[model samples]
Target: MTSTAIPSAPRRSTFAQPIMAGLVTALVGYTSSFAVVLTGLRAVGATDAQAASGLFALTIALAICAVGLAWFTKRPITTAWSTPGAALLAGAAAVNFGWNEAVGAFIMTGVLIAATGAIPWLGRTLAAIPVPLAQAMLAGVLLKLCLAPFVALSTIPLHVAPVIVVWLLFLRFSPRWAVPAAMAAALGIAGFSMGRADAAGVMGQLLPSLEFTAPAFSLAAFTAITLPLFVVTMASQNVPGVAVLASFNYETPWRASMLATGLGSSAAAFLGGHAINLAAISAALAAGDEAGEDRSRRWIAAVSSGGFYILLGLASAAITALATASPEGLLEAAAGLALLATLGSSASSALSDPSSRMSSLVAFLIAGSGLSFAGIGGAFWALVAGLTLRLLIERKRH
Candidate 1:
């Protein structure tokens, strides 16, 4: 008899990791942007049911954008419900214009995104931004998730703290599977901590459901919402989105990606979703060795994510109900665990480069400080600070 050594299994990225990241990040994004989207929805006389439909629209659009972009680029490009864009639209459209105007503004931003992609000058200008600056922006965008685990710890000790410890240790050891593994562990603990998740509604609530909402458009809404949405989606989201792909050595066609983002945003807008843009943090997971280096094969992950998003969209009501039922700390812990790798990568992206070290440090500090001005997010401010510092340093060297 010939003895054969057992072969170790090669890994493919799991549904849980990406899904957890998606779900958790979406939760964060929604919380951040809902005020705006909600105000706009209510201003336009949207019912709670109609608002739910908007969420479904957002999820569906995100799924398609992520799938399409990832398929075209062989990078794990994800499309998200744009948090910053929502904030802009909220302030602009809340009372001044209705849904029609909001949709019109959405359409305009999409046009702008598309036009910029189509135009060589603008595309090239955006492309010319330093990779480090882009990475710093990426880091700034993810700052909230990084701190969430600890935040959960103070509130839900029986659940969040132990799981966080396990997650941190696993990350130090396993790196790739750490997040999913730790999260799995946490949910098990949550069952115990929550003291009757069955009674509290964990199992029954996982079932999916559907919702629908009709659309109405106006010019006033467009005027109020357009500028702000454009700024956040482009500056806070895509700038770093492209950079995250670059940081992982995946090639990104800046113009093509921007075009895709524009198209996706428009597509989502029609469905009542907020502006959709390339995902900054989670893309790292799907693009990494975890998702497989063979670009042809990588589409599987994106395709899977798209399918999952659609499913989430279909079951938007069910998802909302489930999330609403869960303990806030438990959700926070899961999100924190999922983001640990992305957070580490973002930190390293800024710190690893000697030439841009000081600039990146300044960028991280400014962004992580939670400063906001003129409705511009930390990512934009961080980039400005980094660029300014880099320019000054260069001048001194010269």
Candidate 2:
């Protein structure tokens, strides 16, 4: 036997790890805050079908944006709907503008986002907005939603207790899955409680469908919805998303990312979607070490995540149906649980700097108060009050 030289075994492909990470990213991103999104859309006047359309549109839009950006830049650039923006909408004081005008506001927001990247001065102006105040506004916007779980506990103890218990258990054991687990429990309870008639109705409309609304603009919508939404999305999502990727040594193509998200948001808005931007929290799943050790191939994780998002988008109708059918406050409780961490982080950051403490507190209170005046929402007033207070304080110090 002529010294038989056996071929070495083939190296196992490493693609599976990153792909799995991408799947996790999509799952966590979708499950954690989707109730908030639906709630926000409904609050802003979207009908059930419309809200489902919005959710589906947002999921598909961001998924496409994430996949394209990752492939084009060869980087793990993920995208997400602005969870903070949704909270802002959910918390907004009742406005004069209806859903069409809100859609118009969404369009305007997208325009502003695009302009921020395309116009250097505009970007700087947005960047110049005090970080503490922005964070305060965010904390305020998140306050009510974060309190829902506690409020629900008092009202529906028997039904809500199990969901809260599940959340707490997972929170202590596997923190990352806590909110998602709570949402699953809430959905399970909701499904169990559904009468046969309700079940039949839901089964008939399980597939997602799109509903288009022609945009209508107004000063009230601009001031109350568009401006605040733009700031929240930019401040909370896009900027932090860039920072997260940077922490992983990945350089995001800023202008391109903004343009992509801006355009995507505008498109999704037509379908009643609020807004889409870069992924901040979920970006880590696709960009960080969890994706893989091969830095160069990490983009595949983002691409895979986009694929999963597309699949999730298909179930928007069913998810929305289940969420809407839940016992009053149950879904809100789940949404609140999802937002607690964010509320804590935002509150901590807003109060961190002593010099800005008073101003930040003012902003937080004003935003959380649900105040509306002359057709403008509390969010706009919160920023104004906070900035004015800051200016006065600075002038006094000087």
Candidate 3:
């Protein structure tokens, strides 16, 4: 008589692979853009406590979205705060009503973004923004930050040279680590130049304090902060982010993803974070082969990254202190190095279509000009200028 054999269960995949990938992705994402966020917050008049709260809120929001979306969609749907929007804020002077107004504008922008996902026409209208015009506007917003490396070299050659050299070397060999390495080197230089005592003040409020500034909305805040921010976040950050996921053959639920980020952004804005959207640069880190050979399992990588981001949020006090401790030029230098590749790609895309050259150039120039009228920034004007030029050219041809 033969005995029946018992069936064995399948073994589960190890968590190490995806967890490592997630750790790397989280590191790259935060190191590359946190400085820019801090700079933007300061520029918009957020106080030390407020900035820390914003950072804390932004990190936690992104963590939740990244994990929740990846779990539900089974796609490596990584989320991020808007780097371009932060840079745009960094360029603009504080609004007349200050950070409270800015926070109100942030809330409004989040609502509009959420509406885009819920309302078909709004989403399509934003999607229909000319590719050249969007690229030009992003390039224009980045131009000033991209120039920081050169400025650093000229002004603080002794302190900045080492960071530049290390960045260049890594950029050639290990492109992924280049920006973080450079940022570390810059902070090191700054630490040596300015003692720990001076830097300690940034950590004065070590415990994360949620300073709730009741948002006061107005036309000026809407025009200056909300519109420009929403446009760039959608056009530059979210659009390319979708493309990145598609490159990996993930059919991302675009509307759902936008809804997730919009909700996250709205929550974060309550504490002073500018905006959070889909990540552009770090998306590949979590979605690509580097995350794992088995594409089906890569979603775990995003989930892991989200877990780490939550940890980072817990340490916001220390991180903000370090950012505040560093010299302004050091931060600028790091931001410039981080954005150099993006600026090049954006410029190329903006000028790629010959037929749209004039309009694209107009957009780029207006955005780069840093002109503000009636509290509206050059970014909005840039789009208007480009669209008007295109319309005029069409009329003349007809």
Candidate 4:
């Protein structure tokens, strides 16, 4: 008897899985922390329009960087706006300089990032910085923002409680989407607050427009903004981003990644974006098994995510308008909830090393204090103090 050969099951399209992964990566990354970016830009002397422009510029620039890097390297390399750096900006004290000076600081930060890749000694110097202290500084920078959720709940429970509850539900069942869900709920409240007369005007301006500001350098802005932004982006975002990719058995092209992000940051600076760097948390979405079983094809996810980011960038005006118009404490509460996980992780890492615990604590306290001296912000001082204390302690021990 002859047995008929069985036909194999039809193969699924190879592109669909990775494309969906890319879409989720872009959606989650953009929705999660954009409020924080807007708040950070506004904190550093940006007007509402300039803040919106900054957000748009950052989205487009980083999206391009991600697309280029992934396409050229054939790796799932992703770039993102510096979320930790943005937190540093949001927590920064009032500087004596204006928006122009802040723009100069941003340019300087981009130059420094590029230098880190081109100059071996500079990257080494940044690498030599103790991890615990760096994390402590980040934790300190995030403290006020992380506390905002409780502050909002205490003051505006009627408007804020529902958002918090939704965040909690998602956090328990779907942690990755928690912040985005809360942000959506917060936007709903903000939309309800807007009058119909203003809705048409807001709708008409949904497409974003860039606002350029020429750089005006100042020592105060450099000390308060540039130094902290560079250090934070490198330590918290870029370094961790590379490590994350490595964990998935992919080697990122370091110099290329840095140059791409640095140039992107510089190009976007004129339009108010503070900085862009390698993505840490969101990088996994595009680089991991979720993208596809074939490691060779995962780069498609990164490239696709970049396309989605461009689409999202077009909606910046609408997002900024809604967030800025939200009831007092509402959007801030969403931002705070978004940062809570980072704060916890940073705080934990800062205190994990027994030998450096005190120094790390010092850094954390100073950063959280909002102190300013000689027109310099607390973040700068926190690093100095932590390093000095660590050095002195090491000397005594020896």
List model 2 lDDT by residue over 1-398, tens digit each: 57988999987649998899999999999999999999898888999999999999999999999999999999999999999999999986487779999999999999998888799999999999998899999999899889998998899887889999999999999998998899899999999988887788778878899999999999999998888899889988999999999999999999999999999999999999989999999999999989988898899999999999999999999989887777898888889889998899899999999889999999999999988999898999999999999998854875
Clashing pairs in 4: none
lDDT of 4 by residue, 109-148 (tens): 9999998888889999999999989999999999999999
Of 1 and 4, the candidate ranking higher by lDDT: 4
TM-score of 4: 0.97
Worst 10 residues of 3 by lDDT: 202-211
- How do all models score by TM-score? 0.60, 0.97, 0.93, 0.97
- What is the overall TM-score of model 2 with all chains considered together? 0.97
- Runs of candidate 4 with Cα error greater than 4 angstroms are 1-13
Per-residue lDDT of model 3, residues 1-398, tens digit only:
99998988877667788889899989898877777787788888898678888988999889999999999999999999888898888777734558988998899888888888899999989877888888898799889888988898888788778988999999999988998898778777776777768666644645666667788888888887898899889988888898999999998887898888998898899899889999888999899988878889999999999999888677677667766776668777788888888789889999998888889999999888888887777877888899999888933664
User: What is the lDDT of every predicted structure here?
Assistant: 0.59, 0.92, 0.85, 0.92
Q: Write the per-residue lDDT of candidate 1 for residues 20-130, one digit (tens) a residue.
A: 444444333333233334334433444445555566777777777777777766666666766545433322322444555555567777877887779978756655666
Query: Model 1, stretches more than 4 Å misplaced?
Result: 1-55, 66-112, 165-177, 181-257, 269-305, 374-377
Question: Residue 172's C-alpha lDDT in candidate 4?
Answer: 95
Backbone clashes counted, model 2: 0
Instruction: Using TM-score as the measure, name the better of candidate 3 and candidate 4.
Output: 4
Clashes of each: 5, 0, 0, 0
